[model samples]
Target: MTPDTLNFIIIDDSKLDCFIADKIIRNTGKAGDIKSFTNAATALEHIKETPPPADAKTTVLLDIQMPVMNGFEFIEAFEQLPAEIVGGYNVYMLSSSINENDLNRVKNYHSIKQFLNKPLTSSALAAILEEQAQ
Candidate 1:
């Protein structure tokens, strides 16, 4: 599928961060429908509920910390989701935390596409979309 067909999800406790990510992804002109969530619990449920098209491409910019559920918790729940549903999208951790432990923990989840620092950039979003094209 092409970039226009892609659907993205951004999970960050801070609404401002989510807005920034959304803007950057759009500025890259590679994203179509990008959804942002403040909590992982709801986002996890959304991912499980909505099964994306097989050929469709999607990306998720996840935050490391949040109320109720953190990014790691999301990954755990995300992994439990059926492959047919969760495998459709690529997930990346967008965090401001510089803790090695957090980074190492996220790495444990193979599904994580990449680790992005705060203030999502266009280049990162483009790279992710380009990767999904392949």
Candidate 2:
């Protein structure tokens, strides 16, 4: 599956990071609608209030560090949502930190598809697409 066929939701405290990720995803050509939030709580609210279309496959790019609700907290809340709602999306944790503890903690969350390094890249996006295609 190509990124063009998937919707993306980017949650990061850094507005600049969100912009960069949005730009990278858009460059893929025909990419689906992309929404970004600097606050994890707001993002979660949006997810609850506005569910994606039934046929849409949504991928969430979440940052590990944030002010109020961190990525782990966000995942915990997300997991509380209905299974049907949760099943429509895949979550990826993005962090520049190489802390072994952080990495290990990420492994505890079954909702997280993978932990990616900071600065979203086309190659990483492509890899996600390929993995989803399986």
Candidate 3:
């Protein structure tokens, strides 16, 4: 898929954070469809039930500090999906927590592109987009 046609899925427990990210992503005019879920499990279900088009590239912004299903847990579940379905997605873990363990744990997941700090900014999004462009 072309970079300009990239879609997004944001999974964060905080509604405000999700709203902020949705607005920031929209302002860049780089996203196609942006869907946000306060629950990681529900987001996972959506991905499993309704996969994106084969040519579409979808980026997942997952928050690490959630109640029911945390980012790590989500990653575990996400990895179980079929390779073709998982191939269309790029997961980036987002968290406000500075716990050394949390930061270190992200490295273990091959599917996780990077770990980003909370409150997704335009610059960070731009960098991510630029990376995807290549």
On residues 1-134, what C-alpha lDDT tens digit does candidate 2 reach at each position? Answer: 23337789999999999999999889877468899999999999999988777875698999999999999999999999999889888999999889999999999999899999988999998898778767
TM-score of 1: 0.92
Q: What is the TM-score of each candidate against the true structure?
A: 0.92, 0.94, 0.96
Best by TM-score: 3
Give me the overall lDDT of model 1.
Answer: 0.82
Off by over 4 Å in 3: 1-3
Decoy 3 TM-score against native:
0.96
Candidate 1 local lDDT, 1-134, one digit each (tens) = 35455778989989898888888877776667889898889888888788786667578888988889988888888888888776787888988889999988877999997898877877777777777777
How displaced is residue 129 in candidate 3, in Å? 0.4
The residue pairs in collision within model 3 are none
lDDT of 3 by residue, 8-99 (tens): 99999999999999999998887799999999999999999987777766999999989999999999999999998888899999999899
Q: lDDT of model 3 at residue 85?
A: 82
Better model by TM-score: candidate 1 vs candidate 2 = 2
Which candidate, 1 or 3, has the higher TM-score? 3
How do all the candidates rank in terms of lDDT, highest first?
Answer: 3, 2, 1
**Overall lDDT per candidate, in order of appearance:** 0.82, 0.90, 0.92
| Collision count for each candidate, in order | 0, 0, 0
Please identify model 2 stretches exceeding 4 Å from their true place: 1-4
